[model samples]
Target: MSLFDIKRTKFNSSEVISDFSHFKRRLLDEVYETKDELQLVCSSTGIFEQFIEILEGLFLHIRQTQTSAPKIRLLFPKSKKVNSFLEKTNISDLPSVEIQYIHEDEFQYFIAGVDKSISLFSEPRRNFERGFNDSFFNVISLKDSVIWHNSAIFESLWKQSILENKVKDLSRELNRNNVSNHNFVRILAHELKNPIQPILGFSDMIQNNKRLDSDQKNELLKIISRNARKLDIMTNNILDYARMENNIFNLNLEIFDIVQVIEELLGDYTLQVNKKNIKLDLDTLSKKIMIKADKIRIIEVIDNLLSNSIKFTERGQIVISVRETDQYIVVKIADTGCGIDEKNHKKLFSKFYTTDKLGTGLGLYISRIIIEKHLGRIEGRTNTDGIGSSFTIKLPVK
Candidate 1:
């Protein structure tokens, strides 16, 4: 019988429909008739997939023909197969569709309801055709108690599904954070050990090798000093990062000649630069450009940039330039080194992000924080020549 005939004949009563084709046609008719809301519950994953395919076509048809669409809510058993289907299909992208998952054991029957008018119910079956053929349903024009009961059950289950989803999302976030913390500890330990090993080795050699020449002793002392400086820089970076996280970091603001600081810092790197056979150049229009800011933090930033340039450049030169614009004092450290990839430019200043194995990954992050704290800006990009990378820092002249 047609759905209109069935509704007229089966008013205020229920009937068992044993024909799969007839049941499918009636189900589609009910969905098409729905004006406000449509709810569905499917226990069998196989049957649910089939229903999704059928509903996708009906939904498209409704969109083309109808002026308004009903809000669709679907509850299905959570399973690997169903999850895979959802990932592969665009059914969820339908504008009116909202889906939630429940454990397989939580529900045993398939149910569908349309806006207080009709409800289809079926017992668990192995296949979609058999399930639909064995279904019993109710259709009424008035307020039916069966439809009301089904709506209540669906509302309760929907709340439970939302809670469970939130819990799962929180669990995944905690897992990711745990992994990140573990990696942070591992990298910090390795960085700490690297400079300490050399510092201890060189100090011991200087103390125990009494027969060594004066020049040999001086070289060993310089090696110890260099390693010690490295240890100091790494520890300071860690401490500063912690302070920044706690929002307790303070800068020692003062007026100082930035050119003098760069010159002195370059003097320290002369030996390392010569060892790598890389030329380092300084270009400045003024002998001393005085700025009111944190001198120590400014030195830290410039030192970090210069250190990276020297470490990466095996043969080419590094140029440190200081210039004055109308509103800002600009510093550019351009290097002909192994340049960073274009993809990684955005993440360069993110904490714990690094391309170097031995790095603590806090230098650029801390440098960015310090510069911004002083109302300045810093950016890194590939050089125009495409041979290396360049970092630019701009500080307000006023």
Candidate 2:
């Protein structure tokens, strides 16, 4: 159950392996070791039916492919009704699947049928062949050292686990929904902003006048600009959302200093920082932390993240940090603000989900789209006590 990337490796691989069984019933590690045997182990708790549907769909897919290895030797732990359910599934339609039931009473030999390399948890959202070097699940391998080592651990937990099909079906459904939603976003984005230009122009003209009385003009301008900017933000949200749906949005990549970008963006936002009486500090240790990215899109990301911070903070501080690495530049924006709730974490990138009294709720969603386009990632987290929130944007350091 890797969440973020395809074959994402970290220095903490050992620690990650220790926590592999955390989602016991919700996880599945189906391994194919050789030409003779195939093993499917699942953590069975609640989503058993969904898992079975996914596995069935996978076997259906395998039948579609003319691959030589459609022949599968399916095995399950000793259980009467569970074996009965497996028996009822029509394998005749699936000419490729070779089903078998391994009773607890007697079983001496189980061969894993993985050829070349193995991908135990290949997700459809990413490249299928991608795999983790460290095998996290407890699967016994009679083949290579890497395989044997991991499989040895797996055998101990085979009885405790079940064969599941959690992902294959969900991937299909998600892919379909993603395609439809992508089209809808494109249509909706254009519709929302067509009526917004005139409002912004008039607001700008009103605010720039020298003839009107100073106080009244300022107040009227504030209202006009505020509403106009609101419309503009929504329009941006739709555009970003539409772009994200296609998944090929490019970064317009170029090399620029991280420190320079933040410094310039901060100049425009200094007024808002002052208005909130917040201590806005930039902690970029280096004067020129060079990075390759789209400056305009990155600026948009920062502006939205900062705006979110300002909305929650009364008079607290915002600390911006930039750390450059060989592969990525990690930029973190920590804010002392009214933190977000844990329940809302998943919806942070969801369109129009703002808690602010005056916000349109599209900024962070748009920011995420732009960030992802740059081969980057954005994450938001609140403090443990829920008193503050931090937004981190990591961009490739190419």
Candidate 3:
């Protein structure tokens, strides 16, 4: 389904007449009319990638426009990794247009100058697929104000963000990335052997050592079996993530019950929670909230969210909730664990970005890609009091 279709399903004609649509239209109309210098604040890593593509196209068009003014500036997330990505970007080709990267490590959102108007990209309350409807963006123009307020805020951050001390040669960075990939591949092979070799050795030993108790042998077999399956899953995740990175993860879209996918994913995570002695709570959900999407891909998203919850939550309860609006189905996996800092929230979904954790970081990135391909979105939000975090997904109901 198209984004428009999904939007229409949730918002009726009357609601558009009285409040939201008119307000949004007015805001956007003002932005279009104002010829303010453009400033773009990109909050998330996914948004940063999209920012690059969108700017590339916009600058190319501006070059073609006979009377278009220079109206572009960029704000970067202040981080060592983001600085690396920004340094690698080539903006020299568009010499006529000016683009400056400002790292806002402390701000709620970066301020983008859109012509004379300043636009804000606020981090949403929940970032899952169904949370888009709640996202709010506001724009203000500052053509008369020579001494800019947002400029000072942005400048302060840019100053604190470290300089490009080392301009990593393209070839060198590429080589390093390649080494990481190869290392992961090797790890995959080694991990596979870790389980198989133990199983094989234990089986042979148990058969020969007939004096051993049956209970002891059975326990050994269980350990071997469990590790083997864990190894298999890790290998599959690696393979699937690689495919997703290459942009070849195809979605077999069909109408399926969203709740069923949630159930299946929870079934797997429930065992993990039990093993860890963490509380697992789930809401009673309708079994037939049908959504047109790639079933397997959606299941992978739920699995990732649940897995993330389990990893972070040491003892507190992990809650999974499902609800359906007129046009959307929302699933939320919330964990009471180490809540994310304000700065690193957006990077959580970024491909290859991790909080120094165990698994390959591609899980959330691939999950977002899957949702976007199916015309949905996924987002994350943290507790106000540092209790835990919630990752939400919104899928369009067919």
Top model number, TM-score: 1
As for lDDT, the candidate ahead, 1 or 3, is: 1
Q: What tens digits encode model 3's per-residue C-alpha lDDT throughout 261-305?
A: 777666655556788899987775675677788777787678778
| Candidate 2 lDDT tens digits, 40-143 | 53332122232455556555555556365545545544465455556676554565564433334221222233442332331122221353222233222222
**Poorest lDDT segment (10 consecutive residues) of candidate 3:** 159-168
Q: State model 3's lDDT.
A: 0.56
**Candidate with more favorable, higher TM-score: 1 or 3:** 1
Model 1 C-alpha lDDT per residue in residues 1-398, reported as the tens digit of each score = 12332333433556666555566677787778888988988766755755665566665775675447778898888898777766665558767779999777533466788886777765433434565545434232343534544554565456446544543443354366563455655566566556656555665455444587879867766765676677667656766775786699998889989999999989889889999999998999899898989988899899999999999999889999999888999999999899989999999999778999767678999999999998999999998889999999999987
**What value does the lDDT take at residue 167 in candidate 1?**
35
**Which predicted model would earn the best lDDT?**
1
Q: How far is candidate 3 from the true structure (C-alpha RMSD, Å)?
A: 26.2
Where's the lowest-lDDT run of ten residues in candidate 1? 1-10
TM-score of each: 0.55, 0.44, 0.48
Error of 3 at 85 (Å): 48
Q: What TM-score number comes out for model 3?
A: 0.48
What's the distance in Å from true for residue 89, model 3? 51
What lDDT score goes with residue 183 in model 2?
38
